[model samples]
Each structure stands twice: as structure tokens, then as C-alpha cells.
Target: MKKIKTKEAVGHVLCHDITQIIKGVKKGVAFKKGHIVTEEDIPVLLSIGKENLYIWEKREGMLHENEAAKILYNICKNDYMCPSEIKEGKIELIAEKDGVLKVDIERLCKVNSLGEMMIATRHNNFPVKKGDKLAGTRIIPLVIEQEKMDKAVEVAGDKPLIKIMPFKHKKVGIVTTGSEVFYGRIKDTFGPVIREKLAEYDTEVLGQKILNDNPNEITQAIKDFINEGAELIICTGGMSVDPDDTTPSAIKNTGAKIVSYGAPVLPGAMFLLSYYKNTIPILGLPGCVMYAKRTIFDLVLPRVMADDKITLEDLASLGHGGLCLSCDVCSFPNCGFGK
Candidate 1:
């Protein structure tokens, strides 16, 4: 760093903040550190009593922190995401649409491991609304070696490290099982809950079937919904491993490949997921989904709505951070229920 006349400092980066005092009115930074001096800023510097300023000398192989932040943004940007204006050597990514946020954990970790820079992001596979903050990027020092940022770009490869999978509008069907609701023994509460949840997405409920515990009837109901062009089918109740719990078998009877019949998540261990013709999804939700504030259903719904495939490994991975504390005042998605 070297001191130079404020008039000659134009285009040079400030090495320290220029404080301005307005007697009893104000006292604050008139020019922040790292601010590139401009012709228009000379008067303000003079008014702040700074006849000369210390500035960082431009180096051949180093990039300013703002430049490094843009490099990190490039590594993470994808469709359906927009970058915030670079400010104070930092940048943030915001979602341009409601969608599921997907993070490349392996690549993100690799980039962060490079050190001197960082990209902090929200948990993967979670839902984000338009304008929601997705990730932030910045460098540790006021300036960094351009070579380190180059290495980060190389590690990120051609594909970005983060993306927003936009939700697709789906035609859905609901199969409500269990004789208690089927025979009018109890008012159907599951159907309403499922409908309300689906309402959050761009989904059209094709129809819902109320059926007894009979496996054959349940299987035919699922087939009927598929034949009617339902893209997704949800089977509520009858997911437990009991003699009468036949939702799993009914889904299998449709010749749909079962992804998994169980998950490690609590309040949703009996959850079942299958795909018909390797396209349409059929889920067997546990009883808890009808009552629990947040279950495996809430965690998986965003991915399903986004038309992203769920695999056995995906279900197995939910074991960590899967248990819902069931706080008296639920703050799901924002909380660590499924993070």
C-alpha cells in the first residue's frame, strides 16, 4: 500500500475507510475500504478531510475480492437462479422461481476445500420460493491469487455446483385406504390434508378414491387412476407391516417398480415409493402424514413435484436430520427438520 494525493487516487482501491463527520447530524464511513476511487469521489474525500489516501497497489497475478466473488458466482449459477449485485466483496444467489434446490455436495466440498474462498448454500433437495436466498460467495482476503479461483472453476467443471429444479405441473390422484374412512366410520381427514398439501404446487387433483382395506380393490384403484392419465398417485394409510396393511402390495400389483417400501425418517418409517412404467410415481404414505406436522412426505414432496427421480439411496440418506422435533410451533423447511 502507498499514500497518494486524493485527486491522483482515482481508479485505485482504498486501503482504509474514509470517515465523514457532520457534527451532530452524522458520523459514518464516507468511502469504504476496497472502494475504487472515482473522479466524483474526490470532493467527498476532501470534505472528509482526507487530502491523501492509502491504496492497494495493483498486482499482475492477484484479483480483487469482488472479482473473486464473481468467479465463485459463475461456478454456482444455473437456470432459475439470479445473482445479487456484488457488494462489500460478497455476492448472493437468489431463486428466480419456486423450485427444489439441488446442490452438488461432492463438487461444493471440493471447491470449499481449496481454501481462501467459500460458497455457503442452503441444504440440498429443499424447496425455495422466488426471491429466496440460495447461496452466498465471498473471499477471505481483500484480494486473492487468480490461480486459486482458476482451480475452483476447474473443479466445478462445465456444470454448475448448484441449481433450481423448477416444479412441473402434475395431474395427481389420491387413493385413501383403511375401512374406517372407507365405510364412513370416520370422516375422511387424510384426503383433505393431502389436497391442502398438493395445493401448494401446480397440481390438478384428477380424482380421489375412497376404498376398503382390500388389496385387489386398492390395486384396481391405482390402475384406474393411471389409466385416467394421473401422473402421480398417492396411497394414504395401510402402509404399516400389519396383516391388513396392503397398500405396498397394491402398488406392486400395478407392475410399478417399487423404489423403497420404507424410509429411516420418523413419523414416516412406513412410507412407500414406487414408479409405474418408470414414469408415474405411486407413494404409500404412513398414518403419521395425516397428523404429523412434518414427515417424510414434506421432505420428498418438493423433489416429486419437481419431477426429480427419487431412488433407494435418496431415501436411505434421509436417516440423518430426518427426525422432526415436532416443535410446538412448527417452522418446517426453515428449521432443520429434514436438512
Candidate 2:
């Protein structure tokens, strides 16, 4: 940094914020630090009682914050996401469509580990809307070393660190298994709960079947739904270890490869995940899902709607933050359940 006359500061980066005060009108920063001085800016500076100014001087191996911010933007941006205009050396990434936000957490951590540059994003695998702020990046100093920015770019790899996976409109099929609900001894509340959850992602329920605890009938229903073009199949209830429970066996009988018969999540420990023909996903939801406001289903539903493949390892890894607090007010997605 160096001090120079305002007249000679053209084309230089401002080293400090210039404030403008007008009673009852405005009193704030007129020009923020890191702003590039222009020929027209000299008169504004003079009017602000600036006969002399402090500005960044051109130096080797150093980049102004604005230039460094662009590097951060390029490292993280991808399709369906765009960066906002630079302001005070900061650039924010906005989602271009309603979809799930996918962030490469490992790559993002590596980039922020390098000093003088940083990137911050929303929780991964959460739903996002168009124009939502997904991430923000900036250079910490008014001037940063080009080598540090290059290192951050290197850590990001060839692909962008952040992406918005546009949600796919899937036709879902429901198979409510149990003797009570199937025989009308109890009201069927599970179907409505599942439909309301699906509505959040704009998915449609193609068809539904109420089947007793007969594995053969359950298997046939699943096959019929698949034949009718249902992209996702959800089997509710009868997933426990009881001998009478046959939902899991029925799903397996459909020739679907069972990924896992149980998950490590609370209020959803009996959750089952499988794939039909290695393509469409089949979920066996526990009874707790009908009563719990947030569960493992809420955690994994966004990825399923986004068409992101969920492997057995993905379900296993969710054990780290899979327990929902079951708060009375139920502030989820913003909670720590799936972070």
C-alpha cells in the first residue's frame, strides 16, 4: 500500500472505505475498500475532502482482491449456478433452478485451508430454489498472492466445487403393507404423509396399493407399479424383524437388489433401501415416519428426487448425523440432523 494524491490515484485500488454522510438521507460507505479508482472517481474523492488517498500499488506476484475473487468464483461455479457481481472483493453464487445443492465438502475444505482465500456454502444435499444464495467466496486481504489463489484452484480440481442438481419429476408408487391398514381396521395415514412429503419435491404419485402381509401379493404389486412406469416405489410398514412382517421379503421377491435392510438413523432404524434392476429405487419406510416430522427419509429424499444415486455406503455414512432431535417445533433442514 502507498499514499498518493487523489488526482494520481486513477486505476488504483482503494485501501480504505470512503464514507458519505447526509443527515436523514444517508450515512454509509460511499466507496468500499478494494474499489478501483477511475478518472471520474477523482472528483468524488475531492468532494469527500480527500486531497490525498491511499491505494494499492502494482506489485509482482500479487493480485488485487477483485481479481482474486474472480478466481474463487471460477473454481466453484458450475451449471445451474451463477456468481453475483463482485462487491468489496466478495462474490456470491446463486442457484439457477429449484433443485438440490451438492457441494464437494472435501474439495471445499481443501480450498479454504489455503490462507488468504475462503469459500462458504450451504449444507450439502439440501433443497434450494432459484436465486437462492448457495455459496460465497472472497479474498481475505485487500491484496493476495496469485500463488495462493492458484493453489485454491488446484484444490478444486477440474470440476467445479459446487453444483445445483435440478430435481427430476419422478412418478412414485406406494405399497402400504400391513393387515390393519390393508383391511381397513385402521385409517390409512401413512399414504397421506408420504404424499405430503413427495409434494415438497414436486413429485407425483403414479399409483398405490394396500396389501396384507403376504409376500407374494406385495411382490406382484411392486412389479405392477414398475410396469406402469413408476420411477420410485415406497413400501410402508412391516419392515421390522417380526415374523409377521413381510414387506422386506416382498421387495426382495420382486427381483430387486436389496441395498440395506436397515439404516442407523433414529426414528427410522428399520429403513430399507434397494434398487429395482439397478435403476429405480425402492424404499421401505418404518412406521415412525408417519408420526415423526423429520426422519432419515427427509434426509435422503432430496438426493432421491435429484436423481443422485445413493449407494449402500451413502446410507451407512449417514450414521454420523442421522439422529433427529425431534424438536417440539420441528425446525428441520436447518437442524443438525443431516449436516
Candidate 3:
């Protein structure tokens, strides 16, 4: 990523109708920075006899065709009423490619009413600086006007709230380690269960491997996966305290830090969480991970694919609401607690 420049960089916009980009004219053209390109500017660029126009790097940051259009206007982000005056204060605004300005609530309204309204403004020729004055502040009259405004501004300051994005594109790997499972005493039911759960999210299984109960071999399998570009690793089976249960030891041998061992949740109480140095997650799921209707794996899959670093604290905190009631309805899609 390129970093935005300070005030010194000149911003330039496209000068011609290069959308079709006729041949013979070079693709990149250098122009003055901050030069607003209006709809009428297109004919002028063609008048100059230039077909293709693009921003080349300049001492001042060059403005491309898309970025230039977003500036040059005032926008309404939320529908709000201002009853008091505010000036010289900065309000965050989102600009679209068509020169529409989105007024951030910090500059337009108060926190209490932000959720209820999203109003648009049509102020053209609005001069804005990087962190410059957004708009004159105003207040909305209410029984508790001051409190309401405070809430509105606070809400405006934080436009979109952070959330645990569940179904993002992801690649998952599975490591099934257990002598009994590998030797076929138990059918490989864990693989199917894990696959079914992962399908709920936007994830693709890169691959899976089955190995005998050997911590060293399991550790090596996980390492091979990392070398092959596994983002999330799930190790199934052999999580009990038996001497044969070596998945945890093997994961530790790989130099990964265990986030939590044994959450308070049922069926999956022997689950393990660990992070490789690269922060790629390694999960040690119990035998129950294979067939439980709602194991701890079900509870944390979203957070895992969301790429969050699961901590012991996060697991400990789940004690209050982590218990899956296994409702017959299986209302998995809408429920937020498991996440």
C-alpha cells in the first residue's frame, strides 16, 4: 500500500475521455495534483488531442480519474437535524467516485439519533482539507438536548461499528491424529463433521492428512501444511489425558503458543487452541469434534475464519454463553452467541 501524502502533494485528475482509451496515445499522463475533473472536463481533454489519460507519479501525489471525482463536494451521511452551531471542528466524510460527499455524524448530527437517520446533503464546492473543517456544528432540540447531541456526536465519531465477520473467504486444513482413528477402529467421521461445519462459512478445505498417535509426526504434518500455505489448521482426535493423546504435545512441539486448553463447554471440553509464530491458528479438537451436534468447534468457527487471534481469555469468557443447547431447530444462521 501507498501512503497518502501530506499537504504538499498536488492532486491531479483525468483530463480526457480515456475510458475507451484509443491507441497511439500513451496510457499514463502527468497532471497537476488536486485538479478537480468535472464532467465538462472530458471534452477539453479530447480537445487537447489526448485519448488516454492516467496519473503518473509526481512530486505532489497524482490524483487518478477515480479518486479525483470523490472530492469537491459536501455530503450527508445520516439524516439528522442540527439545532446548535459548531465550526472549525473536523467531521469525517466518505466520498464516492461520482463526487457525492457523505457527511460523518461528528460534523452533521449527534450520537443519540445516528442510528435512526441517514441524511444526504447536496453542498457543492465544499472545500475540504485532509483533517480539515467538515461543517459548522449544530444541535437538535430535544427534552435532553445536550445528552442527545453528546450521543449523536459520539456515534458519528464511530461511524460503522466493528463486528465479527463470519463468512469471509478462507482456506482451512485438517490434521487427524490418532492411532485408533487412523487404524480404522473409528470411522473417519470427524472429517465429515468438520467439513460440514466449515461449509457454513465461506471456506475451502485445502487438504487433510491422517496420522498415527505420534506428537512428532503430527507436528511435522502441521509444519508441512504451513509450508504449503495453510491459513487455519484443525487437528482432530486424541485430545484426552491418555498417554496416546499426543496431539497437544505435538502442536506444542511445533513452537505454537496454545491459546486455551479445555474450554468449559461440553462435548468439546478437551479442545485446544494454539497460534504458530506466523499467527496461523492450530486447533486440537477432541474426539467429540467428529460427531457432537454443537461442539466448541461450532462455537468458535466464525471467530477462527474471521482471522481473530483466539486467546485463553476469549475461551474463558465463553463459559457464560458457550453452552450449546442443541436446539432441535438448529437456528445456526441467525444465532450470534456461538460466534
The 0-to-1 C-alpha lDDT of every candidate, in the order given, reads: 0.93, 0.90, 0.57
* lDDT string, candidate 2, 154-271, tens digits: 8889999988889999999999989999889999999999999998887789878998999999999999999999999999989899999999989999989998988889979999
Sort the candidates on TM-score, descending order.
Answer: 1, 2, 3
| Per-prediction TM-score to the true structure, in the order listed | 0.98, 0.95, 0.55
Compared with the true structure, what per-residue lDDT tens digits does model 1 show for residues 233-261? 99998988899988899899989999998
Q: Of 1 and 3, which scores higher on TM-score? A: 1
Of 1 and 2, the candidate ranking higher by lDDT: 1
RMSD of each: 1.0, 1.6, 16.9
For model 3, how does the per-residue alpha-carbon lDDT over 1-339 read when each residue is reduced to its tens digit? 123222222343322224333369755543333244455555655555545445334323432322221221122232221112211122233322111122333454443245432233323212112232223322221012234334444544544321112234767889997777788887777888889888766677988899998788999999998888888899987788998788889999999987778897776789899889957889999877666666787666666665655677768867766667767776643453343
Q: Clashes in model 1: which pairs?
A: none
Residue runs of model 2 more than 4 Å from their true location after superposition: 21-28
For model 1, the stretches where C-alpha displacement exceeds 4 angstroms are: none
Compared with the true structure, model 2 gives a TM-score of 0.95
Sort by lDDT, best first.
1, 2, 3
